[model samples]
Target: MVAPMGIRLSPLGAAVFCLLAVGVIYHLYAGVISNRYAAFRGRTSVDLRDLLAVSVEAAVLGGKEVKAVRDENHLEEKSKGKTREGASEPLTKGDLQSHVKMYNLLKSSFPGVTVNSEEHDNLEDEVTWSRQIPDDILAKVEGGKLVPANRVTVWIDPLDATQEYTENLLKYVTTMVCVAVDGKPMIGVIHQPFTGFTAWGFVGQGSNMQRRSSYSTNPPNVIVSRSHPGQVESYVRSAFGNGTTVILAGGAGYKVLSLLDMPSSTSGDMDKGDAYIHITFIKKWDICAGAALLNAIGGEMTTLRGGRIDYSASPLNTGGLVASIGVDHRALVDRLPEWDPERH
Candidate 1:
């Protein structure tokens, strides 16, 4: 009665206060000075930890101890459950075939798509044009760079390393889709589609990747492609500068995912930003899904030229693009046009 003038408190409120206090105290004990220092609760989520190791932690909602938690369509895994037509197709071959199928589909869907690629007539387009169009007619040279100049989806099997996708072949593949607009990639879809996983970004729209444990999975492991092509060497050199060690990963999507793997890094810790390996010699389709996924998760994807990729072009979007996690991955690409990975 004597304290009736003060705000009333309930057990819930007391519990909340206790949690807040304890968290602060623990944070202090751990020298956790910023939000980035706070530990993340899940394996795939971006959190305080800086190393995003390949992990599949338990579900967060039930606080239960399960084997793993997955967001998106982690159900369509090749090892596990759902099965669809052509499900067993290898990533490299499947993606190549899918591009043609999608290209043909797009030709009917949009009526303006041009196919490029002919290695496999399984339905995929020719190297730079659909089975419907001739290669010479679609091919063009811009500033000495071989530009297919076709506004359509282009397929790139950057690194078909088996080690990366053996465990989760459907979830991890070095495949991309480019959709150009005005001579640039407007929409790019880099999908580990078989796993129902993906990263996508568009010009002016933004970029991001999907979390298999769901986008909500905490403390995700960021992966880099084990092998980046010669075209990408210059951009990689630019992002890492003179002495940055490149961490080889499995797929292109994984390359972009590497930044979100380990948390704990932020604005002040600039090196954390620099550690990212830049994929600059990218095409529209090559980074579409990854771009969208990264953009959704506080990242970026653009041309080494520092402009947004346009998607509404013809044939396909075959320009040089770069994908950066959270830093100026292009800072290297932006300057050294003469960047030659062979020199290294």
Candidate 2:
């Protein structure tokens, strides 16, 4: 039998030892979360949540330290004939396309993550996905990913609300990055890279928002685009006219990012709860990742008429959808005075 040492472990020491053991075990388990699954193969079996997290990490995780310079060399290439059906100006034809730069930047952080785009022929659905991006765009998009139910493609009037970004508008062009899964937003992640603002929602868990400010609150804030106006403004005015106010944000991502924080106006209005949910205007690429993020965070996504959006089958998946959180949803829709909105 082993003899006990004179220095017996006190209760406190014993408790500390137990906690250390638990911590060590947790650390080891966390380190192996992805690896164990690595050997667990199945092309379509990857969890949307994990993949979404990986994508966000890839896009943002190391934004500062790394500087991805735009391929000015592609300027001449862009002048050539290559074009992605609906790419905006300035991004016209290009050889060493900006996609190469974006892909390289993403690869630097995502490591093995791949991006791919191909002509998808979903005969059953009668849709196709295509784009002539630099080959690198194919890196991160895997073959069997869980696409948002309602894939959307949005056309922002201009990049970053050119006029506002020029004047350094704190918030202008703020809009929604809407996503839907089974006609509801399963994930949504709105981002404003310039301000490092990110708002995400995953159905079943909860929706959260973050901003550049060092402040925090628990109120519902409504986002409005100074450059892009929408019925949401009318809703805000109708709902809380005197007390509630709409904040100006630039870009779809910026609008959703603002939702992450309870705005100043709604600071103590519990009656207001959370702001409206339907972001009618949506663009596919604009909301693809955002929708995925929202789905991962536990939220329902769907078209205005509540239809599923298959992101995988098509490229230009632009459509209208709503991302709601704690509001009289059906009642809100009923209020819309549209003769054929029933068909939207």
RMSD of each: 24.4, 19.7
TM-scores vs. true structure, each candidate: 0.41, 0.45
Candidate 2 lDDT over residue span 67-106, tens digit each = 1211222222122222233223222221122223333433
TM-score winner: 2
Q: How far out, in Å, is residue 316 in model 1? A: 12
Range of the 10 consecutive residues with the lowest summed lDDT in candidate 1: 50-59
What does the lDDT come to for candidate 1?
Answer: 0.37
Cα error, residue 304 of model 1, in Å, equals 6.2
Residue 36, model 2: lDDT of 66
Per candidate, the number of residue pairs that clash is 97, 57
Off by over 4 Å in 2: 1-50, 61-167, 170-188, 197-222, 230-248, 262-281, 293-301, 315-319, 339-344
- The lDDT, on a scale of 0 to 1, for candidate 2 is 0.38
- Residue 232 of model 1, lDDT score: 44
